[model samples]
Target: MTYWNQEIETMDPVRLRGLQSERLVKLVHYVYEKSPFYKKLFDEKGIKPEDIKSIGDIQKLPFTYKKDLRDTYPTGMFCVKNTDLVRIHASSGTTGKPIVVGYTQNDITNWAESLARGFTSVGLGKDDILQISYGYGLFTGGLGAHYGSERIGATTIPISSGNTERQLSLMEDLNVTAVLCTPSYFSYLIEVAEKEGRSLKNNKSLRVGIFGAEPWSESLRHRIEERSGIKAYDVFGTSELSGPLFTECPEQNGMHVWADMFIVEILNPETLEPVKDGETGELVVTTLLKEALPLIRYRVGDLASIENTVCACGRTHPRLMRLTGRSDDMTIVRGINVFPGQVESVLMKIPEVSPHFLMMIERNGELDDMTVQVELNDLASDKVEDYNRLISRISHDLRTVLTLSVDVELVNPGTIPRSEGKAKRVIDKRKF
Candidate 1:
């Protein structure tokens, strides 16, 4: 009951490193032999599989990028034959060609096992009814969480994101104990329940929530916990890495990355070398167990850090610190870098404002101006002076954190469009 796979999850750090080294060596050889794309890349780098003798030698291996997946297109990067693949998922292709990932039966089993371990650590089990609000289909969040919940023997509501009314009604009717979705959607759901005179804080059955699919701040997590009366936990994964692979244990510190399955590296943005455990940098991951499409030192494009310190929950695996922002999602305004998570941290600390916000960037003449549209909670007064004062205070805080003067517009609660999936926090209109 304490752990889904206690032996592995609580494996000694020394042994975990040994296991990782062994796996890494095998993975290098496997990819070189199985994947034509990887073989070509390895040959060009003059790196042999035996060169990766230990995890420390990971630097010698060529770093893979999301762009590599796009260049390979549909099946160019898959290590397994088409007959070996059982399923496939892909990115949205919003930028260019979608990055497609294939899964063999073993890959699917391992993905489910990864999430099952996470679910158990978060206290989900057979008696709990879980509602999965993440979008299904090519998107991995919904299906990924679904199998994990089932693996843990929890009754799952395959209610993909949207239809807030039904989502809430089902939660109450089925006495669901946990809900999985993006933090933004769940926050919006709480707002909707309040508008419909059914505040989730009053919902007795629901006690746990697993939120991810987009970056969120600790402040927002606290706000959701306070508003909905649920233990809000962060889940981490990407479509490329078998979605929803890690979740924070009950300790609520950081999401544990299973070392037996994958290797995580946070690299200095400039040096491309590994940073100290707690230092913020770009996240690079290597799939040690994946067979359908194994990635070696894949650049995940997210800005985050790792913690080698064992968790209070007694899981020996390393923890991935909360994501600060994505390299691609950052907005530069007036030559200042701004991440939506930074803005959320500031806004959530203010009692008068809702956690929901939108950033708009525009170019006027030669200057780029940034505007943050913040939502007001019910506690905010209706007086014009109060509104102006609140706006000025928010603008001041934003300027302090972002180092750029920002225009603040107070919108009514729920005025911002709510997303059923990942929240769109930034709208940049400037033509670059």
Candidate 2:
């Protein structure tokens, strides 16, 4: 139970590259023959499947973007027909048309295997009770974790999200050992528990927390660990990449990407060239095992760094560092780049403020104004002078770190919205 598919997980670098190269060679021909979208792209670029001889030649292929998935819409990008698909999941489509993904029986099995490796790495097994707090239905987080929990033979509580009273009741009644959900939701749970005169630190059953679906910082991790008294691990992936695919090992250094199933490349966002090892850049991936929707050189829009050096846990697959921010999520306020992660890092350091926050950006008389609305911790004083002092302190700290002035508005606890899914951190009001 210590290692799932140990042979491939611990494969040598040389042989792993050979396997990737072979898979890439076959994948190029397969996509060219089966997918009309890729065939048209290849013909327009004057490239054939024979051009891709090794993994090094992957650079010759065109990159796929989120827009590409949207342009294809429902089933244009799928290599297999509807009869072959066992399941379908999609993005929220808040911005535009939703990006749909298909999964065959093999795809489902592989995805579950990926997640099972993650669950086992975090010490989850048949004896554990897992509460899946992520939302279900079209979103991938809920069902993905459920499948993995079942795969590991754990007693899963399939509790989607919401119902704070019931969530807490089940945790104590069922003696839930592990939970899967976004970090924000977990933080809210801690707040609710305190209001009810209950402390998670005193809970004997909960041991591990698998948090993802949004970018979080190390400071937040420490806060969760301190509040919940559990080892918190970050799980990472996108709907396009088959939901949650990578998880940190027991060492908790970084998330290990399965080399046999994926080829990851960190590239400069503007130049599209590979960045040096351990340097942050855009994350691009090529799927080797996907049968229904095999994406080649997909630009996943996440900013992160990767280390190929062997981990202390003895896994040879490369580890992706905690994501800094998404390239698309960065905002330009008053001609200075501002990332929500930068804001979170600053907020997490202030003990008077809670981790929950919202960034409001609006245009005022041809200039953009940014206001940060943050909630005060329960212990914070409600005196008028105290509020003013806290606001000034936060504004000064943010200006120092972000190198730009921003207005800070302090509010009572629970003023900001609590999210059961990915927290909506930004609200831009500019028309253009």
Top of the candidates by TM-score: 1
lDDT of 2 at 92: 62
Global Cα lDDT for candidate 1: 0.91
Q: Residue-wise lDDT of candidate 1 within 338-358, one digit each (tens)?
A: 899999999999999987889
The ten-residue window of minimal lDDT in model 2 covers 90-99
Q: At residue 146, what lDDT does model 2 achieve?
A: 92
Which portions of model 2 show Cα errors greater than 4 Å?
none
TM per candidate comes to 0.98, 0.97
**RMSD to native, candidate 2:** 1.3
Checking candidate 1 for backbone clashes, the offending pairs are none
| Tens-digit lDDT string for candidate 2 (8-49) | 888898999999999999999999999999999999999999
- Runs in model 1 deviating more than 4 A are 94-96
Cα error of candidate 2 at position 261, Å: 0.5
lDDT accuracy of residue 351 in candidate 1? 92
What is the clash count for each candidate, in the order shown?
A: 0, 0
